[model samples]
Target: MPELGLDTLKAALPEYAKDTKLNLGSVLGNGQLPEQQLWGTALACAIAAGNATVTAELAAEATDRLKPEVVRAAKAAASIMAMNNVYYRAKHLIGDPEYQSLPAGLRMTVIGRPGVDKVDFELWCLAVSAVNGCGTCLESHEKTLREAGVPRGTVHDALRIAAVVTAAATTLSAEQALG
Candidate 1:
């Protein structure tokens, strides 16, 4: 059986990345997140939160037409970030490459996403990074968004959303506490 590819996605998206030169998740995840950023973020969050069951289930639920770019991005981000963690851990424990900043640029912003208002994406990525405890990734995402003129308030708002979602598990506790 042939696997999924960009041309086989559920939806039609801009053929090219708008401002950004990459849609890393698309390439790495083999063209998963076609153009659905929201979907991709959710899936990515599930993966980052260490819920493999949910991640797999969600990915499976993504049908040919409803498949979102977010889901694919999440998978790709999780996969690459996991590899990155291993490299850093090994280096910290033994010997890391001197120029550690030299990643394969796997997480570079997605193509066709450059023109989309990216404040939300930045925030979402930040949340995922926080959950994964990836300072470098967090910094990179934040810096790029800020440089692109994402206002401070906008960035803060995005982070706030991330915070809320990141603490989604605490909702029950919060509700009980209020009661």
Candidate 2:
């Protein structure tokens, strides 16, 4: 197989997905975040978007730009948030006070000891949560980030990356399915 990256993905997009291609370029070029946070958010959101091609490309790019531990943490954020988003979203939507009192019982030790910085991991999780549409998780992560002194603009940039990555993945998947 040929190498897949952002350029390859962009080129593969159909005419109707032009907005996604443009947004992908703009969001990835955002300067509000440090390299680690920006790329980590991109990689985590790619995994959360559930496209093998996008994930592979972003993972390769992230590996080239981020340290090994940072890459691992980004993946962990994606994996853990996948479960958390579903569970927490359901719990919040159910509106059962009992569920709130009960323990999550999930093994999420990674959130505490993610090899990367806590705030960066939280940001990545926030990005994934945004893609997953878990408002509870988004609010929780955003609050944590804000408390940690992360600027709103930085958080917004991460969400923008997540939004564009998810859109690109969905567009690609739709095109592949229709073809």
Candidate 3:
């Protein structure tokens, strides 16, 4: 299989710094998360970050390893988290008991029929939630993954991918703006 290289994206960054390269290497390696989960989570977080370069790079790397359904699940997770993170974070930050009691009323049918393994989709959601900084979604997805017997190491590695991808996206975006 081909390697996941951030060659082009790195070129857009400031001198292709060591830390970003190392983090990419660590997450892209065959680590705790299965290859599919690693790539899927990376893609979802990339989408959440909304960096075209990173998103395209991750999508290209993920295309072969991930089944179409899995890719869809990743996209779905990012989309849903984009909406949910805003709502839930507001609720949490506002500290309004009434808001907590109110229904979200958002259609999240994709969560039930994600077109991929439910646990895998949940993992993607968890990763995106991490990037979005949604405490509520993070707790819910983490609980679901744990109940489904997902190892903490796997979860940690997925979060690592999310963190690295997010940082890379931010770096690339700043480079684009500055250039």
Candidate 4:
């Protein structure tokens, strides 16, 4: 396969998703985040978006910009958040006080030892949570980021990247299904 990147993703989008293609380009390179945070958030959101093409292309671009450990931490955040978002979102939506008191019983040691900056990991998790629509997770991650002195603009940029990546993935899936 030809090397896939943002250009590939943009080209794959149907005309109806033209805005998504434009947004993808803008968010990837014009965000407030620093290089590591930008690429890490993109990679994590791409994984959470669950598009192999998006994930692969973002991973390739991220590898060129981020350290190996940071890349791993980004992937770990996506993986852990995938499970945590579902469990926590369901518990929050169920509105059962009993569920809140119960032990999660899930192994999530990576959250404690992500081998990257804690705030960066939290930001990536926040981005993934946004993609997953897990309000509880989003709130928790946002609070952690805020307490760590991360700027709201940085957080907003991360969410924008997440939104664009998820939208791109969804559009790609729709295009495939309609073909």
Candidate 5:
């Protein structure tokens, strides 16, 4: 229940000063232009992590390097998105009379093998949902994780990674054009 102090930091940071400002990339892009958005979301996640220098450094690197970092970060974010999508579908299925009646062992083979600890996965889901602007995903993950006893810090940390990765993505394009 401890505060992460993000509100205070947000209030102090300027609009562009914080590399984690990625509403444009996550909400507007809808993850269509990944190469571009990777950098933006990475920065946003990094800022959420409270590591401005490292995120900025990734941005400063040459396009070749910067692009890779963006890819890695964005890929991580996207992977979580896909995972959540699958998990939610499976969850819905479990609510059905047929799936609900199935044994746990069978369920594991069909849906649980790829699943992770709901707490851990939900934390990542929250981050990607925020960056990807999936309100339903965000709300569900947020609600579930809170109920699962995940500390707020854990959620904040995951979001920080998403923000940092998004910001780092932008440097790639800038560097590529110049390089």
Candidate 6:
């Protein structure tokens, strides 16, 4: 794909929403993380947000930079988080001692072996958790990432990618709704 492939997605935003367009550009161009890692995180966030357009566009663009296994791991991160986020978030929010103590019984083998660098997988999980609005998952992933020696700046950049992709997807949804 072209170097500006992400720009194509960014341009899909309504021209009047200059701030969202500019934010997409900035996040996609962020240098705090490697391009591969950034795109991987974005792909996971897009998938977690259930935005088919953004997910397909990001996956197509990321294939050039990320290993196939790495890309798969990003997808797995989104899928697993989709389940875990709901369960864990409910447990946290409910705050009932009985519910919190119960075994989640969630299948999350992917977290242990995501077929990529563990930190990269964790970063993707963090991005997805952010999109899923699971404060529990977010805190867990962020702490794991930081303890694993991942820099805070890199974590921030990954979250930035998640935020921008989510915003862009919402913009596209609004565009579709207005049509």
TM-score of every candidate: 0.45, 0.95, 0.92, 0.95, 0.41, 0.93
Model 1, 10-126: lDDT tens digits are: 121223332111332333233332335444454555466553333443355443434354445456555555555445444445545664656555454452253334554554565
TM-score of 3: 0.92
Instruction: Evaluate residue 51 in candidate 5 and report its C-alpha lDDT on the 0 to 100 scale.
Output: 43
Q: Which has the higher lDDT value, candidate number 2 or candidate number 4?
A: 4
Scored by CA lDDT, what does every candidate get? 0.47, 0.90, 0.84, 0.91, 0.47, 0.84
Most lDDT-accurate candidate = 4
* Model 3 CA deviation exceeding 4 Å by range: 1-7, 10-12
Tens-place lDDT per residue, model 3, 5-49, is 455555455655568867777667545677778878988999999
lDDT of 2 by residue, 1-179 (tens): 76456777777778988998888877785446889999899999999999887888888888989999899899999999999999999999999889998899999999999988999999999999999999999999999999999999989999899989999889878877888
Better of 3 and 6 by TM-score: 6
Q: Is candidate 1 or candidate 2 better by TM-score?
A: 2
lDDT accuracy of residue 133 in candidate 6: 95
lDDT, model 2, position 136: 96
Q: Which ten-residue region of model 2 has the weakest summed lDDT?
A: 1-10
* Tens-digit lDDT track of model 4 for 15-121: 89989989988999676688989999999999999988788888888998899999999999999999999999999999989999999999999998899999999
Better model by TM-score: candidate 2 vs candidate 6: 2
RMSD to true structure for each model, in Å? 13.8, 1.8, 2.1, 1.7, 12.8, 1.7
lDDT of 4: 0.91
Looking at model 1, residue 159 earns an lDDT score of: 43
At residue 81, give the lDDT of candidate 3: 89
Per-residue CA lDDT of model 5 for 1-179, tens digit only, reads 53222323233334554544354334323343233433434433443333454344434431333445444443354464655545555655456667545543422221122233345444545676665555657777778878887667656655655654554444433434566
